[model samples]
Target: VSVQLYANYAIGKDVQAMKAVVGEEALSSEDLLYLEFLDKFERKFVAQGAYD
Candidate 1:
């Protein structure tokens, strides 16, 4: 499982810096879906105690 705080920070950082630099205008439909998927995945990761 992934560390919850670390995962949250990583996602936030990606959206803020990397996404902005890429000039992504806005989140694509796939990006939104991926974010949701990541959310669920991260939750499971935490629950599974695989997070560090």
Candidate 2:
């Protein structure tokens, strides 16, 4: 659980850093899709109590 949380937190920080460096206008379709995938995966993970 701690590992997953840390990984998510790290990914979030990386995304924020990327946005800060490149700006939101620079985000590509692939980046949007990747973010969507992460959202769905997180939702499913929570719904299924995967961390537990």
Candidate 3:
């Protein structure tokens, strides 16, 4: 699989991109599930309120 590279990094860009957004706490199952739920809930709220 082809990988993307980030600026000034030994790792690939795709890896860096993923790393940049996530944190150590997110490694936990509870944290991950909570984040996923919040993300989906926020998106729905934003979509509903976009025109208001």
Candidate 4:
């Protein structure tokens, strides 16, 4: 459930939203891994849309 929410926000390019959703919890190492992915994904996502 949380992962789904994180993915949605990440794909939507909403880093703040993703952070807000996940920041309240005590993140596990696995969750940290996903956050790193989110950072990269958001960067790529914005870059891909920059020309549009």
lDDT tens readout by residue for model 4, 1-52: 7688566656544444555777726556565666667666567654586475
- Name the runs in model 3 displaced over 4 angstroms: 1-22, 50-52
- lDDT of each residue in 1-52, candidate 2, tens digit only: 8788657655655665687889867987766555565566567655586456
Task: Please give the ranking of all candidate structures by lDDT, highest first, separated by commas.
Answer: 2, 1, 4, 3
Q: Write the per-residue lDDT of candidate 3 for residues 1-52, one digit (tens) a residue.
A: 1122112122333333454578544455544444454455446643586485
- The TM-score between candidate 3 and the true structure equals 0.39
Q: Give the TM-score of candidate 1.
A: 0.42
Candidate 2 lDDT score at position 1: 81
TM-score of each: 0.42, 0.47, 0.39, 0.42
User: Candidate 1 or 3, higher lDDT?
Assistant: 1
Q: List the pairs of residues colliding in candidate 1.
A: 1-45, 1-50, 1-51, 2-51
lDDT of 4: 0.60
Query: Can you tell me which runs of candidate 4 are displaced by over 4 Å?
Result: 1-25, 49-52
Those runs of model 1 whose alpha carbons end farther than 4 Å from true positions after fitting are 1-25, 50-52
TM-score of 4: 0.42
Model 1 per-residue lDDT tens digits across residues 1-52 = 4476566546755665555666555777656555666566556654585455
User: Candidate 3 lDDT (Cα, whole model)?
Assistant: 0.43
- For all candidates in order, the CA lDDT equals 0.60, 0.66, 0.43, 0.60
Better of 1 and 3 by TM-score: 1
Query: Which should have the higher TM-score, number 2 or number 3?
Result: 2
